[model samples]
Target: MTEADFAFLREYLRKRSGLSLGPEKRYLVESRLTPICRRFGIATLADLVGTLRLSREGPLERAVVEAMTTNETFFFRDRVPFDLFREVLLPKAIAARAPQRRLRIWSAAASTGQEPYSLAMMIHEAGAQLAGWQVEIVGTDLSTEVLEKARLGLYSHFEVQRGLPVQLLVKYFTQIGEQWRLNPAITGMVSFKPLNLLQPFEHLGQFDIVYCRNVLIYFDAPTKTDVLDRIAKVLTPDGAVLLGAAETVIGLTDSLVPDPQHRGLYRQTAVGRPAMTHRLAAGF
Candidate 1:
């Protein structure tokens, strides 16, 4: 790809998906878009760039964005986040909203449904604790393709093997041929939607817990700050936001502060912060 081709794609991706691609990622872009070019019958990267430039709202534009957005995820990824959820966040949220008997969770950038499904399983395991409560888990991603897969709640054997324990798999999944299908009871507990982090999210409503993990690293500093600001608007004042283990709010935004005891957990920084009476912050 020429300098101009790279420049156009970089700016286009940044504007469309808040992705900050540097010059070193030229090879990565080439590899990802080459298949897209062939699919569109375009002969070259420059030609694909021209086609995209002409029709910003075309199907090709969506294809390009989806191709570039990483959708890597699996059941109970990294372990600690889900551990913290079951042992800490869920209980606090339950008590915090006991009067309303409602619980809301947003799995921002949730890819292929594993993250939200894992949460659903945890809620199912809790059983009576959430018996009469109104629970909602909204899993949103920029890629419509992955959202469709998530809606189906089907995974290959390989997918199930990644971080999903054998006992839980046996308890929640039914074998279909060589694949595993999650029970509708669990899949019904979550809803999937198409969302762009660069856009407004007020329509999604406030949530007691928001998991915007591993998605912010793609954006530049300003975009990261802007996205965090929008997230703060839809998060309950005392709610928690769990970022990726490598991500943090320390130098990013003032609207949230890290939970001292939990590595990837954060709480809203507004006044009237909830007291840490329970040892919820002790492990994970």
Candidate 2:
């Protein structure tokens, strides 16, 4: 792609998706858009951009966003988060919300549903502890295609094997041809929806825990702040926000404060903080 074409597409994506594609990302755009160009009957990236410019409301624009959105995920992509969920977070959350009998968890940017499914498995393991508890797990993503896949709860053997513990696998997955179908009991625990981080999210309702990991690294500082601020708006003040191990809240935004005991876990510290005593008392 020419410099001018690159600049135009980059700006277009930023405006539409809140994702900043810097000069270093030029190759990424080229590699990802090449197939888009061919699929749309365009001769090159320049032609594709021209088409997009002429018809912003067309399917091509949606295709561009879908093509650009990254969907890298695996069963328990990073093991620590899952371990912490089972060992610390879930136990605390269950105890604290016991009287109220309701718990809400959101997997923001949940690609292909692995994270939410992993959470469901943990909750299932908790068994009678969570009985009569109103548990809701909502998984959202920018790409509708991936969200649909996540809702289906089906994965290829290779996909399921990556980062999945053997015992859990045998208990939760049934073989279906070349892929593994997640147990219905586990898959039914989550609800999937399409969500764009660039937009307001207060309408999604408040969450006790927000898993927005592995996504902010794709945005510019201003975009990151905007997204985090919006996240803070819907998060329970004492609720925890989990980011990727490589990501942090420091110097980026003041919407959250790191949990001293947990790596990559940040508890919302804004005014009117919700009671975390229950979670703390549970040894979470």
TM-score for candidate 1, residues paired by index: 0.94
Clashing residue pairs in candidate 2 (N, C-alpha, C atoms within 3 angstroms): none
lDDT (0-100) at residue 108 of candidate 1? Answer: 99
Instruction: Give the residue spans of candidate 2 off by over 4 A.
Output: 271-284
Number of backbone collisions per candidate, in order?
0, 0
Best by lDDT: 1
TM-scores for all predictions: 0.94, 0.93
Per-residue error for 54 in candidate 1, Å, reads: 1.7
lDDT of 2 by residue, 120-196 (tens): 99899889998898899999998988988998889998898898898999999998999999999999899998888
The ten-residue window of minimal lDDT in model 1 covers 275-284
For candidate 2, what is the lDDT? 0.85
lDDT of 1 by residue, 235-262 (tens): 7777889999889887878878889999
